[model samples]
Target: MLDLIASLLADKELDCRLDHPITEARAAFNRAIAEKKTGPIKRLLVEDAVLVTGTDSGVISGRDAQVEVWRADFAQAGRFVYVRTPRCVLPSEEEPIVTELGTWVGKPEKADGSEVRGDYTAKWREVEGKWKLEAEIFTTVKSRDALAL
Candidate 1:
């Protein structure tokens, strides 16, 4: 019972220390993507941040490059509101780094029902009292074609 108590306290402390900050940062990122704005995304990522998309050859390295990729994608004819909702954030009691496990989806901005959903894992590090995303890897598990069935 004492171990359970300690575990609960540790979880609470972790939540207080990192969970809220990471949640806000992630929400801002999602909103930026939905709004097709890269500034917020840029602010939330580290200088050497990396991203692996849900497609082949999607290894995007560097914060500037990732922002450029988003810029190009935003300029495309048809774009979706990309959102990543975190399901769990691993605790880092002594370290400044945390792991976030979540699901991602590209929902059609219209009523097209062209949604592509996937799972993703992101690494975030607290840099100067701010949680900045260091790396994120996404895997596509469901596609638009699959959604129509």
Candidate 2:
């Protein structure tokens, strides 16, 4: 699952980039939704996912659309680093599950030191002897300026 995610990040797939490991994504998404904050930024820590992020003001106004805007902005950024944490194996013996945590960091094209951040968790399922992303959830941590936008 991690390998597939790495490929997507490398290719910069705007949609369905984190679809692998579906369980983790869905868990994170559900948690964020439960937080129900007024701002567009909301987050949750799944069983094995960690959140590390930074963002610009563009996210605040988009509300539910923040993720969409981030994807577009990510492509426009000049300097960016996407980092992934090592995959972890769950303790339960019922199924073979893998969990991974990762983040995407982006620097503005013109600014000297402005940037955006995205953190995510991906879970993979071994279905029919294949590992694929079953769930994912992610959030962008933005700066005051980005939130204001």
Query: What is every candidate's alpha-carbon RMSD to the true fold?
Result: 5.8, 13.0
Query: What is the C-alpha lDDT profile of model 2 across 1-149, one tens digit per residue?
Result: 44566666557543333444543544444333333322222232222322222333221322234444444544553534333332333322466765555654444445555565566665555655545444445557543244345
Q: What is the lDDT of candidate 1?
A: 0.82
TM-score per prediction, in order, is: 0.83, 0.34
- The Cα local distance difference test for each model comes to 0.82, 0.43
Flag regions of model 2 displaced more than 4 Å: 1-81, 87-92, 108-112, 142-149
| Worst window of 10 by summed lDDT in candidate 1 | 1-10
Winner by lDDT: 1
lDDT of 2 at 104: 42
Candidate 1 C-alpha RMSD relative to the actual structure: 5.8
Local accuracy of candidate 1 as per-residue lDDT tens digits, 1-149: 22353376576764523355788899999999888899998999999999988777378899999999889988887777888888767757789988787788887777476788888878999999999999998888788853566
